[model samples]
Target: MQAYRIVRDDLTQPAVLALLQFHLDEMNRWSPADKVHAMAAERLRAPDVTFFSAWDGAALASVGALRDLGAGRGELKSMRSAPDYRGRGAGRAMLDRLLDEARARGMTWLGLETGRPQAFRDAHALYAANGFAECAPFGDYVSDDFSLCMERGL
Candidate 1:
Protein backbone atom coordinates (compact mmCIF):
# COMPACT_ATOMS: atom_id res chain seq x y z
CA MET A 1 0.00 0.00 0.00
CA GLN A 2 3.03 2.27 0.28
CA ALA A 3 4.03 3.96 -2.97
CA TYR A 4 7.17 6.04 -3.46
CA ARG A 5 9.74 7.23 -5.94
CA ILE A 6 12.98 5.37 -6.55
CA VAL A 7 15.92 5.05 -8.89
CA ARG A 8 15.69 2.97 -12.08
CA ASP A 9 17.67 -0.14 -11.21
CA ASP A 10 17.96 -3.91 -11.60
CA LEU A 11 15.42 -4.69 -8.88
CA THR A 12 12.83 -2.36 -10.39
CA GLN A 13 13.55 -2.72 -14.09
CA PRO A 14 11.66 -5.98 -14.55
CA ALA A 15 8.48 -4.65 -13.02
CA VAL A 16 8.69 -1.47 -15.06
CA LEU A 17 9.24 -3.47 -18.22
CA ALA A 18 6.21 -5.65 -17.52
CA LEU A 19 4.05 -2.56 -17.05
CA LEU A 20 5.32 -1.08 -20.32
CA GLN A 21 4.58 -4.34 -22.09
CA PHE A 22 1.08 -4.37 -20.69
CA HIS A 23 0.40 -0.94 -22.15
CA LEU A 24 1.87 -1.99 -25.49
CA ASP A 25 -0.18 -5.18 -25.67
CA GLU A 26 -3.34 -3.33 -24.73
CA MET A 27 -2.74 -0.87 -27.55
CA ASN A 28 -1.91 -3.60 -30.04
CA ARG A 29 -5.05 -5.45 -29.08
CA TRP A 30 -7.05 -2.43 -30.13
CA SER A 31 -5.14 -0.49 -32.82
CA PRO A 32 -1.36 -0.58 -33.12
CA ALA A 33 -0.86 3.06 -34.12
CA ASP A 34 -3.54 4.30 -31.77
CA LYS A 35 -1.40 4.06 -28.66
CA VAL A 36 1.80 5.94 -28.15
CA HIS A 37 3.62 3.54 -25.90
CA ALA A 38 6.86 4.90 -24.54
CA MET A 39 9.71 3.07 -22.82
CA ALA A 40 9.24 4.58 -19.37
CA ALA A 41 12.15 2.79 -17.72
CA GLU A 42 14.50 4.06 -20.36
CA ARG A 43 13.01 7.53 -20.13
CA LEU A 44 13.38 7.51 -16.37
CA ARG A 45 17.06 6.85 -16.85
CA ALA A 46 17.26 10.31 -18.34
CA PRO A 47 18.44 13.20 -16.16
CA ASP A 48 15.17 15.14 -16.40
CA VAL A 49 12.74 12.55 -15.18
CA THR A 50 11.53 11.02 -11.89
CA PHE A 51 10.27 7.44 -11.63
CA PHE A 52 8.22 5.88 -8.87
CA SER A 53 7.27 2.33 -7.92
CA ALA A 54 4.53 1.13 -5.60
CA TRP A 55 4.98 -1.94 -3.47
CA ASP A 56 2.61 -4.01 -1.39
CA GLY A 57 5.37 -5.20 0.94
CA ALA A 58 6.66 -8.15 -1.10
CA ALA A 59 5.98 -7.20 -4.71
CA LEU A 60 5.78 -4.34 -7.14
CA ALA A 61 2.18 -3.35 -7.54
CA SER A 62 2.38 -0.26 -9.76
CA VAL A 63 4.66 2.36 -11.27
CA GLY A 64 4.56 5.93 -12.75
CA ALA A 65 6.91 8.63 -13.97
CA LEU A 66 7.12 12.38 -14.68
CA ARG A 67 9.32 14.03 -17.28
CA ASP A 68 10.18 17.72 -16.86
CA LEU A 69 9.36 19.86 -19.85
CA GLY A 70 10.89 23.00 -18.35
CA ALA A 71 9.03 26.25 -17.68
CA GLY A 72 7.00 24.57 -14.93
CA ARG A 73 5.45 21.87 -17.09
CA GLY A 74 5.72 18.09 -16.79
CA GLU A 75 4.33 15.10 -18.64
CA LEU A 76 3.04 11.99 -16.91
CA LYS A 77 4.38 8.79 -18.39
CA SER A 78 4.57 5.03 -17.95
CA MET A 79 1.78 4.39 -15.48
CA ARG A 80 0.68 0.82 -14.91
CA SER A 81 -0.49 -1.56 -12.19
CA ALA A 82 -0.04 -5.30 -12.05
CA PRO A 83 -3.09 -7.16 -13.36
CA ASP A 84 -3.54 -8.86 -9.98
CA TYR A 85 -3.52 -5.47 -8.29
CA ARG A 86 -5.88 -3.55 -10.53
CA GLY A 87 -9.05 -1.95 -9.05
CA ARG A 88 -7.47 -2.05 -5.60
CA GLY A 89 -6.56 1.69 -5.48
CA ALA A 90 -2.92 1.16 -6.45
CA GLY A 91 -3.17 3.42 -9.51
CA ARG A 92 -4.57 6.27 -7.47
CA ALA A 93 -1.83 5.96 -4.92
CA MET A 94 0.80 6.00 -7.66
CA LEU A 95 -0.77 9.10 -9.18
CA ASP A 96 -0.97 10.94 -5.88
CA ARG A 97 2.70 10.25 -5.26
CA LEU A 98 3.63 11.45 -8.73
CA LEU A 99 1.63 14.64 -8.32
CA ASP A 100 3.39 15.40 -5.09
CA GLU A 101 6.71 14.82 -6.79
CA ALA A 102 5.74 17.20 -9.57
CA ARG A 103 4.82 19.96 -7.13
CA ALA A 104 8.00 19.49 -5.16
CA ARG A 105 10.01 20.00 -8.32
CA GLY A 106 8.36 23.41 -8.93
CA MET A 107 6.16 22.13 -11.71
CA THR A 108 2.92 24.08 -12.04
CA TRP A 109 1.24 21.83 -14.57
CA LEU A 110 1.13 18.11 -15.31
CA GLY A 111 -0.30 16.34 -18.33
CA LEU A 112 -0.72 12.80 -19.65
CA GLU A 113 -1.87 10.71 -22.59
CA THR A 114 -4.03 7.60 -22.26
CA GLY A 115 -5.79 5.38 -24.75
CA ARG A 116 -9.34 6.26 -25.75
CA PRO A 117 -10.38 2.62 -25.95
CA GLN A 118 -12.79 0.77 -23.71
CA ALA A 119 -9.90 -0.92 -21.91
CA PHE A 120 -8.80 2.46 -20.59
CA ARG A 121 -12.15 3.37 -19.10
CA ASP A 122 -10.95 2.98 -15.55
CA ALA A 123 -7.80 4.98 -16.21
CA HIS A 124 -9.78 7.83 -17.75
CA ALA A 125 -12.15 7.89 -14.81
CA LEU A 126 -9.25 7.83 -12.35
CA TYR A 127 -7.59 10.81 -13.98
CA ALA A 128 -10.81 12.78 -14.19
CA ALA A 129 -11.51 12.11 -10.53
CA ASN A 130 -7.99 13.18 -9.64
CA GLY A 131 -8.51 16.75 -10.94
CA PHE A 132 -7.14 16.29 -14.45
CA ALA A 133 -9.31 18.00 -17.05
CA GLU A 134 -9.35 17.02 -20.71
CA CYS A 135 -6.78 19.01 -22.65
CA ALA A 136 -5.29 19.42 -26.05
CA PRO A 137 -2.21 17.49 -27.11
CA PHE A 138 0.99 18.19 -25.28
CA GLY A 139 4.56 17.07 -25.89
CA ASP A 140 5.10 15.32 -29.21
CA TYR A 141 1.59 13.95 -29.37
CA VAL A 142 -0.94 15.30 -31.88
CA SER A 143 -4.66 15.20 -31.34
CA ASP A 144 -6.09 11.91 -32.53
CA ASP A 145 -9.31 9.99 -32.24
CA PHE A 146 -7.69 7.18 -30.28
CA SER A 147 -5.78 9.24 -27.73
CA LEU A 148 -7.21 11.19 -24.79
CA CYS A 149 -5.16 13.95 -23.26
CA MET A 150 -5.60 15.49 -19.82
CA GLU A 151 -3.85 18.05 -17.68
CA ARG A 152 -3.84 19.44 -14.13
CA GLY A 153 -2.25 22.48 -12.59
CA LEU A 154 -0.14 21.75 -9.56
Candidate 2:
Protein backbone atom coordinates (compact mmCIF):
# COMPACT_ATOMS: atom_id res chain seq x y z
CA MET A 1 0.00 0.00 0.00
CA GLN A 2 1.24 3.47 -0.81
CA ALA A 3 1.51 6.10 1.89
CA TYR A 4 -1.40 8.53 1.92
CA ARG A 5 -1.93 11.90 3.52
CA ILE A 6 -5.58 12.50 4.29
CA VAL A 7 -6.62 16.11 4.71
CA ARG A 8 -9.76 18.25 4.80
CA ASP A 9 -10.69 19.36 1.32
CA ASP A 10 -12.31 22.56 0.06
CA LEU A 11 -13.60 20.73 -3.06
CA THR A 12 -12.07 23.40 -5.25
CA GLN A 13 -9.13 21.54 -6.73
CA PRO A 14 -9.54 20.36 -10.30
CA ALA A 15 -8.55 16.84 -9.42
CA VAL A 16 -10.97 16.72 -6.52
CA LEU A 17 -13.81 17.97 -8.66
CA ALA A 18 -13.01 15.49 -11.40
CA LEU A 19 -12.93 12.57 -9.00
CA LEU A 20 -16.24 13.58 -7.47
CA GLN A 21 -17.80 13.89 -10.91
CA PHE A 22 -16.53 10.45 -11.71
CA HIS A 23 -18.06 9.16 -8.53
CA LEU A 24 -21.44 10.62 -9.39
CA ASP A 25 -21.26 9.30 -12.91
CA GLU A 26 -20.44 5.82 -11.77
CA MET A 27 -23.23 5.88 -9.22
CA ASN A 28 -25.70 6.86 -11.92
CA ARG A 29 -24.48 4.14 -14.23
CA TRP A 30 -24.92 1.41 -11.68
CA SER A 31 -28.17 2.45 -10.01
CA PRO A 32 -31.53 3.85 -10.99
CA ALA A 33 -31.83 7.63 -10.94
CA ASP A 34 -33.96 7.71 -7.83
CA LYS A 35 -31.67 5.24 -6.12
CA VAL A 36 -28.57 7.29 -6.78
CA HIS A 37 -27.88 9.09 -3.55
CA ALA A 38 -24.35 10.34 -4.15
CA MET A 39 -24.10 14.04 -3.43
CA ALA A 40 -22.75 16.60 -5.82
CA ALA A 41 -19.81 18.90 -5.05
CA GLU A 42 -22.17 21.70 -4.02
CA ARG A 43 -24.03 19.57 -1.47
CA LEU A 44 -20.74 18.25 -0.17
CA ARG A 45 -19.70 21.79 0.63
CA ALA A 46 -22.65 22.38 2.89
CA PRO A 47 -21.82 23.66 6.36
CA ASP A 48 -22.90 20.39 7.94
CA VAL A 49 -20.50 18.36 5.82
CA THR A 50 -16.74 18.13 6.18
CA PHE A 51 -15.07 16.63 3.14
CA PHE A 52 -11.63 15.03 3.11
CA SER A 53 -9.38 13.66 0.43
CA ALA A 54 -6.50 11.24 0.59
CA TRP A 55 -3.50 12.21 -1.43
CA ASP A 56 -0.44 10.40 -2.67
CA GLY A 57 1.94 13.30 -2.67
CA ALA A 58 0.21 15.81 -4.96
CA ALA A 59 -2.11 13.28 -6.60
CA LEU A 60 -5.61 12.81 -5.32
CA ALA A 61 -6.17 9.19 -4.24
CA SER A 62 -9.57 9.15 -2.59
CA VAL A 63 -12.30 11.31 -1.09
CA GLY A 64 -14.81 10.97 1.76
CA ALA A 65 -16.96 13.14 3.97
CA LEU A 66 -18.65 13.20 7.36
CA ARG A 67 -21.99 14.95 7.68
CA ASP A 68 -23.08 16.01 11.11
CA LEU A 69 -26.53 14.53 11.66
CA GLY A 70 -26.93 16.05 15.09
CA ALA A 71 -27.59 14.22 18.36
CA GLY A 72 -24.18 12.60 18.40
CA ARG A 73 -24.66 10.98 15.00
CA GLY A 74 -22.78 11.37 11.75
CA GLU A 75 -23.32 10.15 8.19
CA LEU A 76 -20.49 9.12 5.91
CA LYS A 77 -20.97 10.48 2.46
CA SER A 78 -19.32 10.45 -0.95
CA MET A 79 -16.53 7.94 -0.28
CA ARG A 80 -14.71 6.99 -3.44
CA SER A 81 -11.16 6.01 -4.37
CA ALA A 82 -9.76 7.11 -7.68
CA PRO A 83 -9.53 4.27 -10.22
CA ASP A 84 -5.75 3.99 -10.01
CA TYR A 85 -5.80 4.14 -6.22
CA ARG A 86 -8.43 1.53 -5.46
CA GLY A 87 -7.21 -1.29 -3.22
CA ARG A 88 -4.10 0.76 -2.48
CA GLY A 89 -5.17 1.76 1.05
CA ALA A 90 -6.33 5.23 0.07
CA GLY A 91 -9.97 4.45 0.69
CA ARG A 92 -9.23 2.95 4.07
CA ALA A 93 -7.12 5.94 5.00
CA MET A 94 -9.93 8.31 4.12
CA LEU A 95 -12.40 6.18 6.05
CA ASP A 96 -10.15 6.20 9.06
CA ARG A 97 -9.95 9.95 8.89
CA LEU A 98 -13.74 10.28 8.76
CA LEU A 99 -14.11 7.89 11.67
CA ASP A 100 -11.63 9.85 13.71
CA GLU A 101 -13.43 13.07 13.01
CA ALA A 102 -16.74 11.53 14.04
CA ARG A 103 -15.25 10.34 17.31
CA ALA A 104 -13.68 13.69 17.94
CA ARG A 105 -17.06 15.35 17.52
CA GLY A 106 -18.52 13.01 20.11
CA MET A 107 -20.62 11.14 17.59
CA THR A 108 -22.14 7.99 19.00
CA TRP A 109 -22.54 6.33 15.60
CA LEU A 110 -21.66 6.69 11.95
CA GLY A 111 -23.94 5.57 9.12
CA LEU A 112 -23.76 5.38 5.35
CA GLU A 113 -25.92 4.57 2.37
CA THR A 114 -24.41 2.63 -0.51
CA GLY A 115 -25.57 0.65 -3.51
CA ARG A 116 -26.62 -2.95 -3.23
CA PRO A 117 -25.31 -4.16 -6.57
CA GLN A 118 -22.27 -6.33 -7.25
CA ALA A 119 -20.36 -3.22 -8.27
CA PHE A 120 -20.53 -2.09 -4.69
CA ARG A 121 -19.27 -5.34 -3.15
CA ASP A 122 -15.80 -4.07 -2.46
CA ALA A 123 -17.13 -1.02 -0.69
CA HIS A 124 -19.45 -3.18 1.39
CA ALA A 125 -16.57 -5.47 2.29
CA LEU A 126 -14.39 -2.57 3.33
CA TYR A 127 -17.06 -1.19 5.62
CA ALA A 128 -17.91 -4.61 7.02
CA ALA A 129 -14.27 -5.29 7.80
CA ASN A 130 -14.13 -2.04 9.68
CA GLY A 131 -17.09 -3.11 11.89
CA PHE A 132 -20.04 -1.58 10.05
CA ALA A 133 -23.14 -3.75 9.94
CA GLU A 134 -26.38 -3.78 8.00
CA CYS A 135 -28.79 -1.20 9.36
CA ALA A 136 -32.17 0.29 8.68
CA PRO A 137 -32.55 3.38 6.53
CA PHE A 138 -31.19 6.57 8.05
CA GLY A 139 -31.76 10.28 7.66
CA ASP A 140 -33.73 11.11 4.53
CA TYR A 141 -33.20 7.65 3.11
CA VAL A 142 -36.02 5.17 2.85
CA SER A 143 -35.86 1.38 2.66
CA ASP A 144 -35.28 0.32 -0.89
CA ASP A 145 -34.19 -2.58 -3.02
CA PHE A 146 -31.28 -0.71 -4.58
CA SER A 147 -29.85 0.81 -1.44
CA LEU A 148 -27.97 -0.70 1.46
CA CYS A 149 -27.59 1.10 4.75
CA MET A 150 -24.89 0.33 7.26
CA GLU A 151 -23.79 1.77 10.55
CA ARG A 152 -21.13 1.43 13.22
CA GLY A 153 -21.15 2.63 16.77
CA LEU A 154 -18.43 5.08 17.74
The candidate that achieves the highest lDDT relative to the unseen native structure: 2
Query: Any idea what lDDT model 2 has?
Result: 0.93
lDDT of 1 by residue, 21-106 (tens): 78667666775553656554556678777777787776777877888999999988878888877988788888888888889889
Task: Tell me the whole-model lDDT of each prediction, alpha carbons only.
Answer: 0.77, 0.93
Pairs that collide, model 2: none
Candidate 2 lDDT tens digits, 1-154: 6678888999999999999999999998998988888999999999999999999888899999999999999999999999999988989888989999999999999999998889999999999999999999987787677899999998
**Shift of residue 12 alpha carbon in model 2, Å:** 0.5
TM-scores, one per candidate: 0.86, 0.97
Model 1 has an lDDT value of 0.77
